[model samples]
Target: MAVHHETAEELVEEVFLFGRALKLAVGNSDSSLLPPALTGVLGMLSIHGECRQTELASLLCLSQSALSRQLSDLVEWGYITRTPDPDDRRAALVRVSDSGFEILERIKESRVARLSTMLGEWSEEQALAALESVRHLKDTFTDQARHASADYTLIAR
Candidate 1:
């Protein structure tokens, strides 16, 4: 039987609601080792290797002072290190430490396991399709946000 448009829309909304609930639940869980902003910064550093503080601040849409405080905390925790940029002695580059990478790996594993358990009944094809759709939606939303406004700030708890 062909799926009705309304049914599909309803299913999409259900999935979105589930995702929101899951995020909130996870955020409240003790197992969440890092705050959202730190997690985001770590993820970006993990992918991009090392970056200057100014660049990171701009990319994360944070003010230099705010980013600096976050960086200070991470450095004190030994999760990341700051080093002088070889090309620019006055500028500093930040990179995830080995400990930080390990933390990221564990976080990725836990998140995958949690999602897989939640989606246990999903077929491989269905999961792949949903993943692709979510990725596309995320990219579209990010692009829209980038062009929409510059006053947005991520409030930290």
Candidate 2:
């Protein structure tokens, strides 16, 4: 079926609205856990294994001090660890600890179950297609943001 042009914007808005709703639902489900930013940091650590604080701050779009506070909190909670960097003694590398990975795994399971329930009515093919489209859209948005940043730098000079 051909999608109406006017409905395109509505579709985008609905996607964002649903995303917000999902986030709210997940946040409400777990009260004692870390905030979303900390959760994101843990997830990033899970994927990247270990990384420098500066790199993590850049990846997370947070100021160094802000990231430091979050990392400190995680360390205090025993969800992450900071060790002296092997390559640079002056620098520290942060990694998600075993406990952190356990928490992250639980979060992943909860998210998957919740999303599965929400999309239970959807056919597997339809859901996979939608997932692929969303992935592409995210990548495209990232690329556009990078280009815009480059343009801004040029204009600033």
Candidate 3:
């Protein structure tokens, strides 16, 4: 049966709620010691390399003050490095630290193991199909987000 837009929205919302709960449980079960926002910042840096504070804040849909607070905490934890932008003395660029990458790797391993156990009953084909569907969703969402951001930027200018 074809899913309607309202059904899709409800399903996505439920998934997000469950995902947040799972993230909290994972955080409590392990010594990873990361907040959701910090994890997001780290993941973005890891994927995108260095980014200006403003750009990162825009991408994260966070206010300047909020992003600054997150960046400060990450820097203090040695999970992120912030350096003055050479081209713009007033701005800073942020990147994930080596320690950050190490922590991410550990977290990834732990999560993967947990998922493996959770999905152990599922056949390989089932797992692959699920992964493929999720990947498609992610890609579509990312592309739309980029387009929306671009439009917002243009309007702002």
Candidate with better lDDT, 1 vs 2? 2
Model 1 TM-score? 0.72
Q: How well is each residue in 17-116 modelled by candidate 2, as lDDT tens digits?
A: 9789977877555435667778988888788889999999887888999989989989999999999999999999999999999998887777777778
* Model 2 lDDT at residue 86: 93
State which candidate has the highest TM-score. 3
The list of candidate 2 runs beyond 4 A from truth reads: 1-15, 149-157
Considering TM-score, which of the candidate structures 1 and 2 is the better prediction for this target? 2
- Runs in model 1 deviating more than 4 A are 1-19, 25-32, 141-157
Candidate 3 segments exceeding 4 Å error: 1-18, 21-31, 153-157
Model 3 backbone overlap count: 0
Tens-digit lDDT track of model 3 for 22-81: 776565444555766688788888988898988888777889999899889989999999
The weakest ten consecutive residues by lDDT in model 2 span 25-34
Write the residue-wise lDDT of candidate 1 on 1-157 in tens digits: 9879999899779879977896765533424677767877888888878999998987788999999988897898888999999999999999999998988887777777777787889999999998898789779778888765543543321
Model 3: residue 91 alpha-carbon error in angstroms: 0.8
